[model samples]
Target: MFSRIDRYRWSFQDSHLPEVTLFAGENVAFDQRAVRELRQMLEVQGTMNRWSSHAPEAFPEGAGLQKVVLTPDFHKAKGIPVGTVVQTRGFLLPQAVGNDVGCGMRLHTTSLTAEQVLGHQKALIPKLRRMFFEAGRNIPMNRLQREALLREGLLGLMDTTPRSLQEGLWQLFHDQDLTHEAEHTESLGSRRARNTLGLEDFLGQRDFTRDGQIGSLGGGNHFVEIQRVKNILHPGIAHAWGLRKDQVVVMVHSGSVSVGYTCASMIREHLSRLYPAGLVHPRNQLYPVPNAEVHEETVLQNWDALNAGCNFATANRLMLALMVRAVFQDLEMPTDFPLLYDATHNMIWEEDGTYIHRKGATPARGFEAMQNTPFRFTGEPVLVPGSMGTSSFVLAGLGLREALSSASHGAGRVLSRGQAMQGSTQDLDDLLRQHRVVTPVDFARTRPDVAREKLKELLQEAPDAYKNIQAIMETLQGAQIAQPVAELEPLITVKG
Candidate 1:
């Protein structure tokens, strides 16, 4: 039997539920359909309960979560609900951090104008394809990465696995200088039991080191978009970012893909074991294991792996950009190629060596801010990607607002991939056309199931599905921890 706690319009019937409370105020309201959808997306809801903020230990003395803000796009994800900003006293949840480890948008605007792209696209298609193909062929992995155990393979990707797979092994044999900063996983949120989310389990679902994942836009919401730098929200900021309206820019969004799934899968097992047979909760918030100190070594190992995984994620985009650049050169487009910003959505950081978990959120750093070393910075850029056929915003961090200096990761998904695939194909196609988006390949190009899965994610993430970003910006007016640099509009979308 489990101890029960009750609260108004909510209850901590589940132990885990007691750990969290949706701060839905009078303005916050959800229809039954939305509620049902959210509950379903929260895959583990049946095992957890809900409570208000005033409830017991949910809001500990010092949690990064000073406030919980949900937009119209709010939905459920691994453990924490998407759009949920959590500030824990001292911990991080790998699931909340998300599967696409270090998955964030990187935007680059060039000096070219629109006439050049529209005129040369016919000549540009082959070049773009070749770029992706070649990048898919060669992706670099460091020594530590060689050993991390997370790589990928597509059925097409798998058959063509490059000899690079053995390069890591060869390096070790040759005694080369390929060392990496290991990932540390121990933290206030880590459970005492072994983390099932280790790379040992999920590494090979796809291999970037090989030909499997490189140049490949993996399944689900990830995409590479060709956008027009249509607007500069803040002139001063835009100048700093080197962006100009009407210029062409490219945006790439992807994460650890299958590798991340395995890491989180392993951790889920740990959470399951942490809960005793008789113990039950309305919810299943990540239960950090006891004897956390002892797990420090293991935690560091996991953290290092996660960090390197982040490096992999970065390399993923870099390789793709190299292709984009090659495409531009092939078409002789005048657009320049420069990495504006690189950020990660799923991550845990040390604030002065303390733990900070950021899930479905990005850092909203300002020009000057002090965040414990390795952290103190004038500000960091925040990449906010919108729906594939919509607009993406670029902002610089201010500092801390509610808790951690943070902002929503994207238009938080409102539906699950399964739910998103429900609309008619024609309707989705029409929507894209209306948005002026030209997908590189049509729906037929994707596996029926994979296409549906992506559609589901797209539906949940459609521009209409998110809160008006401009309104969000208005809400944060003066809270300019992140000054708007540019407003990017999508032209072409490549989703795999």
Candidate 2:
């Protein structure tokens, strides 16, 4: 099913798996292990190409699938491939969206320069330690406020937030209407999601704390970094985004916290029971909820629950960014950290009247498609963050139709977390010293041993665990899906 196409791309076709389109296949070196796993998944019943006559009338549109695109950052994940974009006509697949519902990136530009932060590293590092590790007490919000943000996202919380916090937000976004900030965020940062699982089931019996995961950084490749725009590739787009060379920015990579996981688990369990016993595949547990087979009430309930998870994730990222902003305010730095854009990679989106499941791919709608957005002239700002200690990119979408209006999320993982920890000769202290990144683990005042162990786990997320960022960038530009606007280098990195 897998064969060579060209120097840069590869094509995969099978009787079961959806047609695969991969970019930079030669450069990144496709892992056959992951491809075999994908094939096992496709062989399952009710998938894109494996539906049987005896199966429920799931795909009324006859498979209801268009294509599956793998971005340049394409690589192996556990059951599904990361950097995958699946387009379906009338069916929605839960596995395609993966576990993280609203996993995404948020960029904020500040008036402060990289030099200022670096110079004050000693004073700033300890402050950051307290802010992230001290139970996030610095972020001004009560249980009710957290619930409002989760239910209604940034817009709902903006109104309910304390006056001081609201003022701080306004100070950051002086020009743009604070109420309309959701327009800049993907999916408007909120959806009409309801609590389908009921309050007790969703919260779990032992977990009584409200918004316990709101401002958390979360583990596994999630981080908040202080970066400087090293260079501007497209001057006009950079200017439009209010980004300048050498300017300081905060880039957050996180997701929906525990809310998304719970939602996914609930949906999966519901569908698993309904799946035909004969059609179930051992290697693949992915269940597709076809629009035709599902009752209208069930559909609405599922969407509401999914939207709630997505909204929670979107709000969680914002809250984390706000926490960073609070730190900057305390440090007497530029508190005017206006949001440049917020985009999620792990999601299922309805675009151009079709459902697209982007596991680790960013939506790259073209200028014409986004004519109503503030960046219609330049297309959406697709923020592609690099692995830790590497150069992240801000790119303008070219909106290539064949590519499903999507691009890579990051340098896709070359090594899993477990693989990264084995046969490692790199020194953690030297690596951080070279990158000049500050973390709470670095300043463990009381538990130095525990901090050191935490630091070792972080080392597993090193740039070496992922594909080359330069190659991924070149592939996107070569494919004409997205063009780089600016490159950002990290200075301070905070990981959970």
- Number of the top TM-score candidate: 2
> Which parts of model 1 are misplaced by more than 4 Å?
1-73, 125-210, 269-285, 352-354, 370-378, 415-419, 433-462, 478-481
* Candidate lDDT values, in order: 0.51, 0.74
Query: Candidate 1 lDDT, tens digit per residue, 1-496?
Result: 1121222112113343313333222232333344443344343322222221323243233333222333323555545565544443333445556666666566666677666676776556545544453342344443234333233211112223344554422222122111111111011111122222355433343434453554556756677777788888878667766778888887878776665555555555655554445554434455542214534554454555465456556545645655566566546563446556656666766565345566666666654553432223335667777765777877767775543666666655544556555656556766765654433444546678776654555564455544455544443334343566678877666665
Most lDDT-accurate candidate: 2
At residue 207, give the lDDT of candidate 2. 21
CA shift of 265, model 1, Å: 2.7
For each candidate in turn, the TM-score is 0.68, 0.90
Where is model 2 poorest over a 10-residue stretch in terms of lDDT? 199-208
Misplaced by over 4 Å in model 2 are 15-17, 44-52, 55-58, 139-148, 159-177, 196-210, 277-282, 423-426, 443-452
Q: For model 2, how does the per-residue alpha-carbon lDDT over 106-179 read when each residue is reduced to its tens digit?
A: 89888888888888787777777677776643333555555555567676667565455443333443334565
Task: Quote model 2's TM-score.
Answer: 0.90
Cα miss at 421, model 2 (Å)?
0.3
Instruction: Give the Å error, residue 255, model 2.
Output: 0.3
